[model samples]
Target: MAQDFIAPSILSADFARLGEEVDQVLAAGADIVHFDVMDNHYVPNLTIGPLICEALRKHGVTAPIDVHLMVKPVDRIVPDFAAAGASYITFHPEASEHIDRTLQLIHNEGCKAGLVFNPATPLSHLDYVMDKVDMILLMSVNPGFGGQSFIPSALDKLREARARIDASGREIRLEIDGGVKADNIAEIKAAGADTFVSGSGIFGKGRAEDRNRYDTIIGEMRTALASVGR
Candidate 1:
């Protein structure tokens, strides 16, 4: 089965009502919560960490929390996020000193492990650790900020990555992050991305006072992906 998943990035959600936003999005059919963990050092942006992840759990949001570690010294935070209720944890290969060990650590903590490839990061990172990953996140745009235009080169990269995953014979997910919207989602899926992460593309579309647009935008994306039988 082609499992097309839509993970709404909480980085663009209303911070004051994060729990509500998460509840609503999940209710609206989001597969996962794309939690952005940015350290000021690694990605030139400082965002939330395990504390908020924990809070979300405490708030009764039991959906999978897909934590993206945009931080250096990634190993130390692995245990924290795992303890805080993360279901899937992914970190940039360039940020981790020992890629295999980091993936091992995440698995050891009882979460699905993944490796993130930045817009310019090489696919060679997957050469040794493909066996260790549950998902491969391809950044369609740079990591630091949201709302950037999708980079077209990602289509080729996704196709190449898809071939590698198919050859690996593992059920690893191919996730595309940044600038995903309804219009281009089908093309992205056609390129072999089964999972998606969209920040401004979803949250930025609604009027400031209305968060219910989450359902509308997410449904549109699902419809787009479904139209092609993804």
Candidate 2:
């Protein structure tokens, strides 16, 4: 399995002070910055684009930026994100007219490529492109929104995706996004998720009052993850 990662999604962060929020979370031990790029057409919500990603780079955030594109016609925007300093770019397979080509496009632009599977989306999308992807993101809740409860069935999907990764003997990351909190991170890890994405779970209330607010939650999450194999 790849090293466990805690990617704090910026969707739930206070956008007015996003740079500080990201800096604080990373200092609190977050492994990656999960950038949720939602297009109103594809996911019913509009979110930040590559410009924000470029701004973060300018803001001096050096941690890996995991850009999750919840947008249709994903191919056209691949180069923009790569140029914007995205370390990894993941898109839903259904959004791309040419999944394989899109994956290649990301790599061509010098960024790692990944595919995301929504709660109901089948894993068959991985059948042909397993070798082409650097990561596999499984949405525990539906996309477009944050703070939704995790769907129990995602556990089974995680296990299935894990099996595929192990079988291929590839270093592909199995990432689970949405509703991942300190309380359930261990269960999710035990199910074979090496990368965890949390939005509201990490950026909960009390942030303004406590400069160290992220420390407690991130520490608790790490503590939970530490107990997974035991």
* Model 1 per-residue lDDT tens digits across residues 1-230: 44888998999988988888888889888899999899999988999989999999999988899999999989999999999999999999888889999999999999999999988998998998889999999999999988889999999999999999999999999999988999999999999899999988887866467756578888899889988753
Tell me the spans in candidate 2 whose CA falls farther than 4 Å from its real position: 205-212
Taking all chains together, the TM-score of candidate 2 against the true structure is 0.97
Alpha-carbon shift of residue 201 in model 2 (angstroms): 0.3
lDDT for each residue of candidate 2 in 1-230, tens digit (9 for 90 to 100): 47889999999999999998999999989999999999999999999999999999999999999999999989999899999999999999999999999999999999999999999999999999999999999999999898999998999999999999999999999999988998999999999999999999999743667854698889999999999882
Best of the candidates, lDDT:
2
Q: What is the lDDT of candidate 2?
A: 0.93
For all candidates, what are the clash counts? 0, 0
- For each candidate, the alpha-carbon lDDT, in order, equals 0.91, 0.93
**How high is the lDDT of residue 14 in model 2?**
90
**TM-score, cand. 1 vs. native:** 0.97
